[model samples]
Target chain A: MTGFTTTESLAAYMPEQNIDTDAIYPARYLLLMEREGLGPYLFHDRRFHGDGTPKEGFILDLEPFSKAQVLVAGAGFGCGSSREQAVWALTGFGVRCVIAPSFGEIFAGNALKNGLLTIALPEEVVARIGAAAQRGARFRIDLEECILCVDNEIVATIDLPEGQRMALLNGWDETDVLLQEEGDAISGFETRHRMAQPWLFQGST
Target chain B: MGRTLYDKLWDSHVIRSYDDGSALLYVDRHLLHEVSTPQSFIAIEKKGRSVRRPDANLAVPDHVVSTTNRHLPIADPLARAQTQRLVENVARHKIPFIPLDDQRQGIVHVIGPEQGFTLPGITLACGDSHTSTHGAFGCLAFGIGASECGIVMATQAIRQQRTKTMRVNLVGLQSPFINAKDIALAFIARIGANGAAGHAVEYAGPVVAKMSMAERMTLCNMSIEAGARVGLIAPDDQTFDYLRGRPMAPKGEMFEHALTYWRTLPSDADAQFHRELTLDVSDVEPHVTWGTSPEDAAPIGARVPSPEDLTEATRRERRRRALAYMDLKPGDPLEAIAIDVVFIGSCTNSRIEDLRAAAAVVAGRHVAAHVKAIVVPGSGLVREQAEREGLAQTFLDAGFEWREPGCSMCVGMNGDRLEPGQRCASTSNRNFEGRQGVGGRTHLMSPAMAAAAAVTGRLTDVRKLMGGKP
Candidate 1:
């Protein structure tokens, strides 16, 4: 529900391709139910050992990276599971933006709803951002201007679909947006649909 | 030009199209499971909105339900609480629910089509990624997140972006002991994991045409593994026959009329596609994943790939990590890799046909001494049917546990998990790191291949066990 316009923060990079949702937030913690307080469980399997101790030299556990709000990750980031908790975990862990070459389609959609901006840049552009983040650069994500900056230098010009850009800028609840803008269209479609395809509604009522 | 099946389904369901290229798609069926619905229900309650079409939604507790001790309360407190919340939420919303103890209670994907809620030419959405399984019936089905689930619950529609269409033509001879799971993995390995990203892949050609509905579901179910949100097959006699006489399907004249429309649901011969691929399955042997991603798969005869062989830096790093996690040495033969567990269930390959295939492999043989194999049916009905057909007995006699229905070891949420460092030959969709359990190594394979692994104490070519060509 928080509007996202721009953020200048420490950036982190994880160069492993296909970092799936299960790794982001493992399935074992899924039963915790409530969406909040999932920060500790973010990358639970990767962050901790079997005895629940943090692994030494882990990138996120390191200084500066622990406070990172921007992540420049490898290709196919968040590429498994439809668990919205992955987004919840990322935002909870203070990651406001993720720049990757590609993302799991479902995870990308989920990220939009949660205000965690996902920017799918070209592979080379993502690599450049990852390199910058590895050098401890502070990145600025300007959603309104559609550009990403590192150390005050524009690294890549970002482009987002207009509707997504509007939603993120204003923090619009999609359900409310639909009802307010296209309520009549929904009702009319339902009425016309039932009459045209009566068999689809044969026994449900 | 002619239209694609996706275009037809999308056009029929669109309430309105936005200039940004996304459309408000009317959801005809919405499947819900315990794990994904809690937040959606909370969001809807906070918004002071009620379900607009409760009749269109079906709820079940699958992810957290214990496969063992079905009549008893859930053992894990957190899991129990989550399942209980679904019962309360669905009761309040008046959504039709299949209780955990119901014979029909199973993975949402399995039960939807089984109950006829997944009819062709409809737009179906679920909170789980495997919702693409319903697309096998020529439906516009794909997964949505919790917020979209909330929107669908309240408004019965979702704002969805248009997807490029792809036709994956399945060519080549149908190999023995090769199921749709193998074909899925084979093509995914060839195309990499994100092969069909942003595209709705439609499986076609003679090989696909000869597949059964269950096999078609297996292929579509793994569409997500290939980065495809939706996978489809043209509705044919096989699809209609599978749906006929089902509880919720149309009846009498209604069925006839539905068929008339469904007949026109396939992509026209001259339909345009954004991409096209031809998979020759004649060379697609039984595939087992050697690494974390589904794309890191190879045939049973192949050896583990060395990271040094990869030219790309990121791919090399991924393989190095996968090999370390799997405890597999580079150049190790895949068939010789030992497994400690054999899981023969999941929404991917837990249908009656899948059960029968595994049962046939383990009928007269016994499970290896070191392997702990289990057969968890997809649904309670599937379990009962397997029992009537004596497949359950065969598995039991083979030293395998015949358990109740639900996603057991696949997601590992129901107290069915592998210990750290355990290796499993599983018939599940994913081989992601720690997917079955923390530090667990999973080799994704077909049910028959898993059965072969169970009997041999290692990954074995399933054809050798079946007395066929190896």
Candidate 2:
């Protein structure tokens, strides 16, 4: 995963709310083992015809927005399924960041691990950005400053937890980070937990 | 000052809390299915790490396995490889696996509780969004991504930010026709899709208290549809009675000891919640989704909503798109809408109770000649139990195909899919576009409701078919 510091890119807006993971990456392609090159299948039904031709009028299929690396989406983006391929497809399609009013809990967590920045702003702020995005506006998301900028003017402030911010800025492997800091703590907890609930360990396997 | 069930579960599992407000949580159980484990297993092997608690993990191949002819090889090479990868990964890690042929093999969510792997007050994690199904046992269960799966396998711990609590109190007597599936859909419709976003929802009150373990699991399974990661009903006598003789539950003295702890798992009377909503189940009717999103649901008797009724542009546009995708128009009666297929299975509603419900509606009745209906039990055990009870025979007699245990038409991952433009009445948790097939239109409803649709070839009120006693 690449460390995220700042990125300025054209934003594509999706006006639909509750854009579920199933719609993002269809269930049929779930068996594909390889994560890369999933861009072709992103929004397969909505973006392409059965003949595999790109559908006209789709924001991602249209020029300018086709190259967009930032997506300004609706509320509750990525709301269904825990398929990480949804994130993989977005990243593979060159999307580096997504700004929405809210996100599915599992989708947001998956986004961070794949180096896709997900910023949850208030609904009004997200709407403002989305409005600018529809007009082919280019936005800059500054992780270091935790602000969203359009035309060098601050439009919204991004409030990410410090740990998430640090993790993004440094590309920290979460398992390594957890093991390095809380390895002993986890061990201690397990010892006490086992003692407290011996039934949990009683020959279940 | 009292603690909610979520608070109790969270406090018990915390290994350490970081200044950033994220806590390291130790997971007591991790369930793995084929689709989500391959990438995690590869990541762990690359990192030179081994599963920290092999015994804490269980693996099953459900998502991509062929639901028919389990003895024959899987025809789709890609799906076959995915299932094969799970087998190899589990064997290498020594994780307990329920292979496709095992009678215990089923949807991870259904079998978790069935085997007593899901217990009250323990934290469980899975790579599927429906992991919240286990929360019916009062566990702090939630879904994780593949990377988080690797973290759990490597360290037996996951970093999580605390979620505020939401208490959904079902306050009135439920109508006979309104099952947990209706309650789930009703709740999602009341609260938009993101109603419970970032909050842990504890289902409480008389309605939830009276629901069976299967019904509670069905309700909690769809909690993710409302955007809640965790959905719990505090463990009660129903939970204990369900787990008493399960294969993995504590035995004898150990069971007694566990019971003492389990008895304390419910929220206190004065427990505080960040958000609270009281719903009167007496007024709720059998619900079915008319649009793509679960929130786009209404009573089976209602008409399709007009997008113009929505004031907000985004919401209006969403409604328009959903209507267009579903081929539905404003003022169209939901019950009059015809369906091409009926599916009565999935982790959400494939338990034996669900089958019995469908079978009761199907007994001595034939499926509509034009409709293709199928019943896929959640597990082999469930399949056996249903067969023993003659529910399988009843479905077969009704012209519904009785298939093996797997996530069949719900996901359509194993080649059991609807053709393009086909409409279906499904008991699955999700009704998203292309969820069952590329161009399939899904109307999410209860199993009995789906069975009614099969018999009528249209979305009909199950209560009418049940002779007014659903």
Candidate 3:
């Protein structure tokens, strides 16, 4: 996962709420078993017509927005399905940060795991960003400062849980986080737990 | 201070609390399916990590297994590879696995509770989102992503943040025509798709207490569709009775001991919730999604909502997009919409009870000539039970194809899919675009509703088909 501290980029505005995983990357494309090259499939059903032609009116197909690195979406973005492909698709499309009023819980976790920053701001502030993005404005998201800025003015100060913030800032793999714990303590707890609840380990052998 | 059932369950599973407000929580049981775990197993192998407690985990190949015929080998190259990978990974790691040929093989969520792996007062994790189905047994069960699956497999614990609790009181007696799926769809429609975004929902009140364990599972299964990670109902006699004498359940004296523990697993009288809402199910008619999102649902007889009905411009625009994608028009009656297929199976509503309900509707009635109706049982056990009760014969007699168990047509990865522009009345939880297949439009409904649609060749209200007023 790429570590993130800050990025300043133009925002691609998607005003629709409940932009589900199925829309982000449709199920048909999920059989490949690999997450690579999913960016083209992002919003495939919505962005393309049945004849395989691009829908020019779709937000991602418009000028300037096609190369956007920030996605300013409406409330409840990524609200359906548990597929991590959704985050992968966004990152594949070069969307480094997603700014929404709120996000689905699982989608947010998956975003953090994949190094995509998900920033939750007040609905009013997000609406303002949506308005600004419509006018081709650019914004910067600083993870260390927990703030979003446009033209040197703070747009919103976001709230991030300490664990997620540090994980993003350091690009810490979960396995590394667990490995940092004291080995003796983990083994000691395991030994005691196995002894106390032998039935719990009945079928392992 | 009174604690809700979710609080009690979470508190009991806490292995260690961290200064950063996250905790290492013990997972009592972990369920795995093919699509989600292949990447996790690959990651574990790359890291050279062995599963910490293989006994605590169970693996099955459901998502990619072909549901058409269990006797034949999987024909799709990708599906076969996924199933083979899962089998090899489970064998190498020494985890208990249910092969596709095994009688116990089924959807991970269905097999967990049916095989007695899901018990009261435990913390369950699965890579799939519908793991909330286990919460029906009074457990703290929720979904996890691929990364979390690898973490739990390697360490038997997951670091988590405590979630706020929301209590949804379903007050009043429900109509007999209203099955649990209707109730869940109604709830999701009432609270928009993201209503429970970050909370664990506890279904309480009179209507919930009266529901059977299977119905409770149906209700909890759709928590994901509403953006909730966990949904639970406290265990009672219904739960204990459902678990007694199962293959994996504890024997006589131990069962009694377990019962005593389960008896103590309800929310306290004065438990506080961060948010509380009451839904009266007494008048909730059968619901069907008219658009891509689950929240875009209306009663069976209601007209499709136009974007003009929405006050917010964003919402209105979304409605217009959804309407265009679904190929629906404003004021179109839901019942008047025709369907090309009717799928009666998924983790959501494919249990024995669900089969019986659909069977009753289509017992002597033949499916309309133009509709392709298929009934895929949730698991082999469910299929066996349905066959023993002659439900399979009833469905077959009614021209509905009776198939083997797997997640057929639910996610459409295993070669069961609809042709482009085909509409389906599905019992699966999701109604997202292409959920059943590419360019396939889905209308989520109950099993009976789906069966009724099959017989009528359109979206007909089950109540109306039963000679009752719509």
What's candidate 1's i-RMS value?
Answer: 1.1
Q: Candidate 1 has which clashing residue pairs, if any?
A: none
Measured as a fraction from 0 to 1, the native contacts recovered by model 3 come to: 0.57
Off by over 4 Å in 2: none
- Candidate 3 residue-wise lDDT at A42: 89
**Residue pairs in clash, model 3:** none
Candidate 2 on B1-470: residue-level lDDT in tens? 88999999999999988898889898999999999878899889998999998889989998888888888999999999999999999999999999988999999998999999999989999999999999999999999988889999999999899999999999888887678999999999999899999999999999898999999999899999999999999999889989998998888889989999999989998888999999998988999999998998999989999999999998998889889989999999999999999999999999999999899998999999999999999999999999999999999999999998889899999999988899999999888888898889999999889999999999999999888953
User: Between candidates 1 and 2, which one is better according to lDDT?
Assistant: 1
TM-score versus the correct structure, for each prediction: 0.99, 0.99, 0.97
Give per-residue CA lDDT, model 1, range B144-219, as digits (tens).
8888899999998888899999999999888878999999999899888988889999999999999988899999
Q: Of 2 and 3, which scores higher on TM-score?
A: 2
Those runs of model 1 whose alpha carbons end farther than 4 Å from true positions after fitting are A203-205
Worst 10 residues of 1 chain A by lDDT: A196-205
How good is the docking of model 3, as DockQ? Answer: 0.60
Sorted on lDDT, best first, the list reads 1, 2, 3
Q: Give the local distance difference test score of model 1.
A: 0.92
The sequence of per-residue lDDT tens digits that candidate 3 reaches over residues B370-469 is 9999999999999999999999999999999988899989999899898889999999999887889878899999999999999999998999999987
